[model samples]
Each structure stands twice: as C-alpha cells, then as structure tokens.
Target chain A: MGRRIAQIICFAFGALLFALYFSQHPTARSLNTAVMIDYWQIIFAITLLVGVISFVRINLSNIRRGDNRPYRIISLVGLAVMPILAIIWGIKGNSPFMWMFEYVQVPMQSTVFALLAFFVASASFRGFRARSAPAAVLLTAALLTLTSRSSLEGIVPQFITEAADWVRGNPSMAARRAILIGIGLGSLTTSLRVILGIERTWLGSDK
Target chain B: MDWGVIIAGLLTLAIFSFLYRDNPAYKMAESLLIGVSIGYFLVITWTNTLMDLLFVPLTQDAKWPLIIPLALGVMMFGRFHKRTAPLSRIPIAVLIGSGAGVAIPAMLEARTLRQISATVGPLVTESGLPDISLIAVLVGVLTTLVYFYFSREHKGALGGAAKVGTYFLMSFFGTTFGYTVMSRMSTLIGRVEFLLSDFLRLTQ
Candidate 1:
C-alpha cells in the first residue's frame, strides 16, 4: 500500500516538473522556482537533520558496545558541543560556534585534503609505469601537462607548452565531449525508466 | 596567547602525524574533524535553510504552500522506526522523481545536443586547406564513442578504432591526473604557508 502510493506520488511530481520545464507562463515559472528553491531546501535541511540523528545513534551504539569508546565519546562530544555553543553564543562572526569552525573544522578539513597530495604522489610513482605504447603516450601527456603548469614552464622549451595546450584543446576535449554525450544519453534513459516505473531500485525493495 | 593559532596548528600537525604512522593523535583529530564538520553543516543548514526558507516565510509571511514540504520533510523522520520506515519512501520518491525530471532536459540540451553540434562543425579551413587538428578531434570523438559501444564483438575495423580510442582515453586520464595532483599540491602549499606564516610566524 505504501509502495504504491509512493510510486504514484513520484510519477505525479515527476510529470508535473517535466511539463513545467516546457512552460514559459508566469504561474508555471513561479511554481517551478518555488518547488526547486523553497521546498527543495526545506526537505534537504530536514534530511540532513535525519542524517545527523542517525550519526548520533550509531555513535551511541558504538559507545555502548565499548568499541573504540573514547574516540566515539569524543565524536559525540564534538557533535553535542557545536549546537550548544551555537544556542548560547549564536553563529555570528565572534561567536563560539564560528570560532570553533575557524579554528577546528576549517584547519582540519584543509589539512585532510592536503594530505591527499602525498598519497597521490606515492600512488603515481608506483602506478605510472610506461611499459606499453598507450602508457608511454599517457606518460608523455602527463609530463607535458605537469611541466606546462609548473615552474618548469619558464625553463622548458616553448613547444612543450604549445603541445600540452593542443592536447588539452583537441584530443582531451574530444574524449570529454564524447563522455558527456554518453552520460547525457544514459541519464535520459535512466530518468525515463525511473519515471515510467521500470526502475524500482530506489524503492529499496522489489516486494 | 593566540589560542586560535595554537589550536589550529596542533590539529593540523595531528592530522599530518598520519604520514609518520596512525597514532592516538591522528585518530582523535580524525574523529573530531568528522564530528565537527557534520555539526558545522547542521548549524548552517538550520540557519540558512530551515529557519530562513521554511520557518520565516511560513510564520511571518503566512505562506501556506510551504506546509506541504514541511509535512514531507517530517515524513522523512519515519525512517527511525521499522514499521513507519516505508512512509519515508514517499518523500524519497518526490526527491528522486523531481531530480530525474529536471535532469532529463538539462542533460539532453547541455551535454548531448550542444556537444554534438560543437563536434560536428567545420572540418576544413576557409582557404580550402585541410584542418588537421579538427580532423584529429573528429576522429578522436568517433573512436572514443566506438570504444564505449559494446553491442558488437570488437574485431576487424572496430578493433582498430577501439585501440585508437584507448590512446585518447589514456591522454584524458593522464591530463586529469596531472591536474588533480597540481591542485592537491597547491593545497599542501597553502597549509605549509599557514603553518609557517600564521602559526609559527617564521615567514611573512
């Protein structure tokens, strides 16, 4: 019963939105904007709340089980503290919430991303072997691109940068364009399948 | 005392400690990062999305249409329990359905039609000389598409084209990797600069 109603709602909304795209009428445009902007944001925000709740629940269970209890407790503390701070001091510029964000979240986040550089370099060293003809071509292209972007551009011959630019503009662009077209066609078919009820994977179960 | 610099610098070093080996410091920093990031996003979403978009409009302006999404959003909470879990599907359906609907026309126009039109133009120059670069691009596109087409057994001419396609794909992958590494290195440089200039006061 629930599944059928869900499917009906999905089809109705999908069809309405699709039809709305073709219409240039003021009412149609406004309705489309309202759904896309206002309703979408509201639902998305609620969905995020639901996710945070699940995160808390999972951490609580882990703590109860004594699996990495200290780490889990720290996580829970961090989670709990942010909202408390926000409620007390508010999220304005000089608030405790913003302070935590600037000092804690932003620094750690960027450092984590920056850490990827080491792994990528290590991975490339191990994996970027030019044993075959195609691999050699790939290596050359990579070297050209890297050098062109790096400090070596000033020292390297002018032809190297020109070659890299050509590779980027011509061959790279062509492959990307083909992939994009393929993605578009694939998306169109999948969307049609979804709207037509041919795809039920998102419904979580066939039953 | 500059507590911000001290706190941020310590956290950054704790994360960087993973390079030596995963220790207690790294684990704690990682845990705190995950929790704090989620918390930050939660607050932002509440302030920028829920309060501003849903609550303010609904309460102050009395926009009754927002009640529908609010109810749908509430329905999402049904997932917390087993029996009521299926009720969450309704809202999920709406999100997925509308997303797919919007994507169809957008994808077709931007990705397929535009790309095709762009690719299928002006193979020759105005002076009647052959434009080799344009020719190469056309061939690259056709061959790449052929490589992706799995309907037939790749033999004879198809095999040849597919082989050529692999070269173009390899070039694309190589350039992409180069760009990714460049960006990551830039981020690493930024962190180093922050540590030296902002935290340690070693460089200006």
Candidate 2:
C-alpha cells in the first residue's frame, strides 16, 4: 500500500512537470518556476539536514566505540562550533561565521583541491607510458596541451599552440559532443522508466 | 597579528602534510574540514532556504501552496526511524520524478539536439576552402559514437573506425587531464603565495 502511494506520487509529479514543459501559458510557467525553484530547494535543504543528522549519528557512534576518538571529537567540535557561531554572531560581513568560512573552510577546501595536483602528476608519471598508438596519441596531446599552457609557451614554437588549439577544437570537441549525446539519450530513457514505474530501484526494495 | 591568516596558513600546512605522510595533523584537518563543511551548509540551508523561502513566504505573504513542499520536507525526517522510513519514499519519489521529468526535455534540447546541430555544420568554409578541422570533427563524432555502440561486434570497417575513435577519446582525456592539472597547479601556487606573502611576510 505504501509503495503504491509513493509510486503514484512520483508518477503524478513527474508526468505533470514533464507535461508542463510544453505549455506556453502563464500559469504553467509560474507553476514550473514555483515547483522547480521553491519546492525543490526546500525539499533538497531538508534532505541535506537529514544527511547531516545521519553523519553526526555515525560519528558519535564511532567515537563511543573508541574508533579514532580524539579526531572524531575534533570533527564534532568543528561541526557544533559553526552553527553556534552563526547563531551568536549571524552570517553577516565581519561576523565570526564568515571569519571561520573565509579563514578555515575556504583555505582547507582550496588546499585539498590543490593537493590533487601532486596525485595527478604522480598518476601521469605512471600512466602516461606510450606503449601503443592510442597511448602515444594521448601522451602527445597531453604534452602539447601542457607545454602550450605552461610558462614555456613563449619559448616553445608557435606550431605547438596551434596544434593544441586544433586538437581541442576538433577531435576533443567531437568526443565530448558524442558523450553528451549519449548521456542525453540515457537520461531520457531512464527518466521515462522512472516516470512509467518501470524503474523501481529507487524504491529501495524488490517487494 | 592577523589570526585569520595564521589559522588559514596552519590548516593549509596541515593538509599539505599528507604529501610527507598521513599523520594526526592531516587526519584532524580532514575531519574538521568535513564537520565544518556540513555545519556551514546546514546554516546556509536554514537561513537562505528554509527561513527565507518557506517560513517568510508562508507566514507573511500567505503563500499557502508552499505548505505542500513543507509537508514533503518534513516527511524526509521520517527516514530517521525504521517504521516511518517508508514515509520518506514519497518525498524522495517526488523529487526524483520531477527532476527526471525536467531532465528529459532539458537534456534533449541542451545536450543532444544542440550538440548534433553544432557537429553537423558546413564542412567547407565561406571562402570555399575545404575545412579539414570540420571534416575531422565529423569523422571523430561518428567514429566515437560507433565506439560506444556495443551491439555490433568490432570487425571489418567497424573495427577500424572504433580504433580511430579510441585515439580521439584518448586525446580528449589527455587534454582534460592537462587542463585539470593546470587548474590544480594554479590553486597550489595561490596557496604557496599566501604562505609566503600573507602568512610569512616573505614577499611583496
């Protein structure tokens, strides 16, 4: 009974929204905007809070089990501190919340992203071996792109940049376009399946 | 003293410490990052999303239709318990269904139709010169699509086209990697600049 209701709601909303896309009426447009913007955001926000609760519960259990207790405690502290700070100081300019975001969160986020450079370089060193024709093409293209983009761009011959630009414009663009087309078709099919109730995987049960 | 810069620099170093070896500092920094990010998002969602969108409009403007989504959002909390878990499915279904519905037309127009139109442009330029790049792109697209078509066995003409497609795919991957590395390197340089100029006061 519960599953049937859920499926009905899913099909109803999905079919309604999909049908709404084709309409030029003002009411349809407003309905689409309201649901897509307001309703979606509200639901998504609540879902995120649910996720955070789950995360906290898991971490708390881990801490209780003495699984890296100190680090887990520090993590919980960080989690608890942000909301408290926001509540006390608000999230306005010069507020402690903004201060933590600017100083602590942003820096760590960027550093983590930056850290990927080392891993990428190391992976490339091991993986960029040109043992076959396709591998050679990959290596050549990578080198051309890297050299053209690097500080050595001025010192390198003009043809290198031209070749890199050509590769990016032609073959690379084609590959990406093909992949995009494939993705579009796949998404369309999957969406149809979901709306039609053919895809029940999201229901989280076979029964 | 600029405590902001000091704290940021120390945390940045702690993250970078993983390059040497994973230690307590790195673990602590990683855990803190996860926790703080969740908290930050939670606050933003509350203020920017819930309070501004739902509460304000529902109370002041009397936009009663907002209650539908509000009820759905509340239903998401049902997931916390075992018996009430099934109730969460309705909201999840609504989100997924609507999202999928929107995605159908959106993906078709943006990803499929536009890309095909772009790819199938004139092979010859206005000046009457044979556009080698366009020809190459046409071939690349066709061959790449052929490579993805798995129903047919790779033999004869299909094999050759698929082989060429692999080269194009590899070139695409390589170019993407190059760009990714460059972006990461730029971020790394910015961190180094911050450490030297802002934190250490070594540079102008």
Candidate 3:
C-alpha cells in the first residue's frame, strides 16, 4: 500500500512538472520555480546527509571488523574534521576550511585525474593492436590526432593538420551525433515509463 | 614559504606513487580524498542550502509551503531504519521521476533535434563548391545510423555499409581517447609545475 502511494505521488509530481514546462500560467510558473529552486535545494541538501551517514556506517563497520582499521579511522577522522572546522570557523575564501580544501582536496582530485595520463599512454600502446581494418583506421586517427595537437604540429606538414581537422569534424562528429540521438530517445522512453509508473524498479522489493 | 603548497605537493606525490604500485601512502591519500570531499560538500550544503534557502525563508518570510519539502527531506533519512525504509522510497521516487521528466525534453531538444538539424544542411557551401567535409559527415551519419539499426539482418549492401560505419565509429573513438589523454596530461603538467615552482622553488 505504501509503495503504491509512493508511486502515485511520484507520478503526480512528475506529470505536474512536465505540464508546467508546457504551460504559461502564472501560478504554475511560481510553483515550478519554488519547487525546483527552494524545495529541490533543501531536498538535495538532505540527500547529502544521507550520503554522509552511509559513509560513516560503512567505515565504522570496516573498523569494527579490523579490516584496515587505521586507514578507515583516518578516513572517518578526515570526514568528521572538515565539517566541524567549517561550521565552527566558517568557509570564507581565506578561512582554514578553504585552505584545507585548496591544499588537500584540490590537489588530490586533480592528481587523481592526472594519474590517468600515464595509464592512457600505457593502455593505448598495449591495446591499439591493428588486427583488423577498423582497428588500423582507429590507430591512424589516434596518431594523427595526437600529433596534430602536440608540438609536432609545426614539424608536420600543414596538410596533415587539415586532414586531422577534417577527420574530427566529419566522421567523429557524425558518430557522436548518432550516439547522442540514441541516448536522447532512450532517455525519453525511460522517463515516460517512470512517469507512467511502468517502471517499478525504483520501488524496492521490501514490500 | 606557504604550508598549502607543501601539503599539496606531498599529496600529489602520494597519489602519483600509485604509478609504481599500490602502497600505504596511496591508500591513505585515497581515503583522505573521499573523506574531505564528502565533508566539504556537507558543510557547503548546510550553510548555503539549508541555512540560506530553507531555514531563513521559513523562519523569516514565514514560507509555510517550505514545510512540505522539509518533511519530505526528513523522511529521506527513514531508509536507515527497517520499517520506515519503504517511506523513504517516496522522496526517491519523486526525485527520480522529476529528474527524468526534466531531462527528457531538454535532452530531446539539445541532443536529438538540434543535432539532426545541424546534420541536415546543403552539401555545397555558399562558394558553390561541393563541401567534401559536409558530404563525409552526412555519409558517416547515415551509415552509423544504419549500423545501429539491428531490427533487420545485416547482409548484402547493408553489411558492407555497416563495415564502413564500424571504421567511422572506431576512428571517432580513437580521436575521443586522444583528446581525453591530452586533457589528463594537462592536469598532470599543472601538478608537476606546482611542485617545481611553488613547493620546491626550483623554478619561478
């Protein structure tokens, strides 16, 4: 019964918002803005708390099980410390909170992504075996692209760069657009299914 | 001179150390990253969204309508408890439903219609010359679409066309991969520069 009501509520809100997009009524516009801006913001904030709770729960379990307890403790401590510091000291641009963010979080995130550089280079060399015609074409395109973008652009002839541009603009873009079209249509179908309650996967099997 | 630069350099080295092999430093840095990111988001959400948007409006402006979302938000925490887990589904459903509804129209307009319109243009440029690149794009798009059309058996001319489409798709993927590598390399360069210039004072 509860799940049924939840699904109904979900359908109603979705339909209402969908209708609002098409409608120009003043009341609907105000409600739409309020729901999206004010209401959604709060809801999203509450969702973040849910994430923090889950993190704590899992890390605590790990610690209790004696599985890398020290690292788990470090994680929990790091998690707990920043928010406490922020709330107590505030997170202005020059505050300790922002300092920790700029130093620790910023570098860590960037370095994490940066680590992909070595992996990509190694992986491409290992993976780009030209066993087939399509594979050969792919390898050629990749090489041309890298060379066109690198310092070798000056060393390589201008015509090669033009060819690289043509390849990127034509074939690459067409494939990308085809994929995008597929994704758009698929999303529309899935959204309609959810709105009409045809998709019940969101409703857990607990009931 | 600055502590921030020192800490950042150390963290960068810690993460890069994973290139050698997974070690304790990498593990610690990874954990710290997750913890700090979540913590940062938590505080930002509390101050920026909760205090500013919800609490202030409800208390000061007396926006009674805000209570509806507040109640729903509190109910989201019910998932942790066994009996109320079903109740939590309500908010999750509304979130998913509304998200899908919003995404559907936006994606259709942006991704599908606009892309198709862009793809459909004259084969010749204003200079009255045959636009070779445009022709290539049109042919690539059609063949790629045909390749994706799996309702019918791919044989004869269709099979040949699909083979051509496979090459186009592979070339596209390759270029995309190269571009991604370039982006990642730029980030790595930035970190290396920071270490040399800011932390080690090796270069100005």
Each candidate's DockQ score against the native complex? 0.83, 0.85, 0.74
Candidates 1 and 3 compared by TM-score, better number: 1
The TM-scores of chain A alone, one per candidate, are: 0.96, 0.96, 0.93
Docking class of 2: high
Spell out the clash pairs found in candidate 2: none
**Worst 10 contiguous positions by lDDT, candidate 2 chain A:** A198-207
| Residue-by-residue lDDT tens digits, candidate 2, A45-93 | 9899899889889999999899999999988999999999999999999
Q: Mind giving the per-residue lDDT tens digits that candidate 3 earns over B110-144?
A: 98899899999999989999998888888888888
Report the CAPRI category for model 1: high
- Report clash pairs, candidate 3: none
Candidate 2 chain B: minimum summed lDDT over ten consecutive residues — where? B78-87
Residue runs of model 3 more than 4 Å from their true location after superposition: B125-129
List lDDT for all candidates, in order. 0.91, 0.93, 0.88
Q: What's the lDDT for residue B113 in model 1?
A: 95
- In the range A5-69, model 1's lDDT, one tens digit per residue, is 88888888888889999999999999899887887889999999999999999999999999999
Quote the chain B TM-score of every prediction.
0.97, 0.96, 0.91
Candidate 3 per-residue C-alpha lDDT over A119-140 given as tens digits, one digit per residue, 9 for 90 to 100: 9989987988999889988888
